[model samples]
Target: MGAGRPLEVDLRRVWDAILYINKTGCQWAYLPHDFPPRTTVNYHYIKWMTTGFFARVNAEVRRRVRKKTVETRNRVRGSSTVKASRAPQNLPKNPALTVIKRSRAESIIL
Candidate 1:
C-alpha cells in the first residue's frame, strides 16, 4: 500500500488513536502511552479531518457494516431449520431469561 507513497507512520494506528480520543472526549495531552504522542495524533487528525479523510473512512465502514449485517441475517435465516432441531427440550423458562437473552443478543449483534 505504501509502494509509491512515502510512509511516515501507520495510518490505521493513527486513525484508531484519533477514534479513541473522540470516543473518550479526552484532551490530546491525555492520550494513553500506548498511542503515539498527542501532538502527532492531533496533527494527523486535523489534517485528515480537514481533507474529509475521516468522512471517507466512515462511509466505507458503514457500507461494510450493512453488508455484514445482511450476510449474517441471511445465514441465520438459512439455519433456522437446524436451529429448531437443536433446541433444548429440558430448558426451564425463567422470568429473567428475557433480560439475559437481550443482553446476549445485543452483544452478539454489536
Candidate 2:
C-alpha cells in the first residue's frame, strides 16, 4: 500500500524552521538556509494550522507541563493571597458642585 514517493526533507528541520519564523516574527521568504526550504515549511505550517495540529500538540504539552508542576505550584503561592483595594484613600475627594438654575426665559427657549 506504501507506493508513493517518500519524504526527502527531515520533518524536524521543517518544524525548526516554523519555530524560528514564529520566534523571530520574520517573513516566510526570509527563512534561513540551514533549515528546510521556505515553501516546504510554510506548506507544513498551513497544513498544521488548518488541521488544528498545532492546537493538539500545544494541548498535550501543556497538560504534561501542568502535571509536572502540580507539586511546586501550591508552594509558590504562600498562605496569604494578595488583595487589591477597591477604593484608594490617598486621593482627595471631589469638591461638591453647585448647579445654578437657568432663568425661566432661557429654560422656556431651550
Candidate 3:
C-alpha cells in the first residue's frame, strides 16, 4: 500500500528493468513478478542513465566484440554499485504506487 524498504538494488536487475521498460513500453509497476520492485528498478534506471553508465558499457562491449573503436565515446567514472536484499512483499504491485514514485524519478530524467 506504501513504498517500502528504501534500499539499494542489483545492477543486473536494474539493467534488465530498463531494457524491459524500453522494449515493452509498459509502466514500471506492470513488470513481471520475477523482477525486483518497480521503485528499486526505476531508481537504478534513473541513476545509471543520468551518469551515462550504460553508454560506457555498451561502447566497451561493442569494442571488445567488433575489434574496432566506437564512434561514440563517453567519459567513464567509478559508479558505486548497491546490493539490496529482497524487496518487501508487503506492498502491492500496482500502478498507483509507481505513479507517485515515478513523479520524483521523472524529474531526474527531464
User: Which candidate has the top score in TM-score?
Assistant: 2
Error of 2 at 62 (Å): 0.7
Stretches of candidate 1 exceeding 4 Å from the true structure: 1-7, 81-110
True-vs-predicted CA distance for residue 62, candidate 3, Å? 1.9
For candidate 2, the 10 contiguous residues with the lowest summed lDDT are: 93-102
TM-score comparison, 1 vs 2, better candidate: 2
RMSD of each: 15.1, 11.7, 31.6
Off by over 4 Å in 2: 1-3, 73-110
User: Candidate 2, residues 1-110: lDDT per residue as tens digits?
Assistant: 47898889899998989999889998988888899889989888899999999999999999999987985676555422333344454976444322223455567888
Candidate numbers sorted by lDDT from highest down: 1, 2, 3
TM-score, cand. 3: 0.49
What TM-score against the true fold does each predicted structure earn?
A: 0.57, 0.61, 0.49
Better of 2 and 3 by lDDT: 2
lDDT by residue (tens digit), candidate 1, 1-110: 54695867787788889889889998888889888777778889889979998789889999999999999999998799789989898887795988899999999999
lDDT of each model, Cα atoms only? 0.87, 0.81, 0.74
* TM-score, cand. 2 vs. native: 0.61
Superposed Cα deviation of residue 110, candidate 1 (Å)? 56
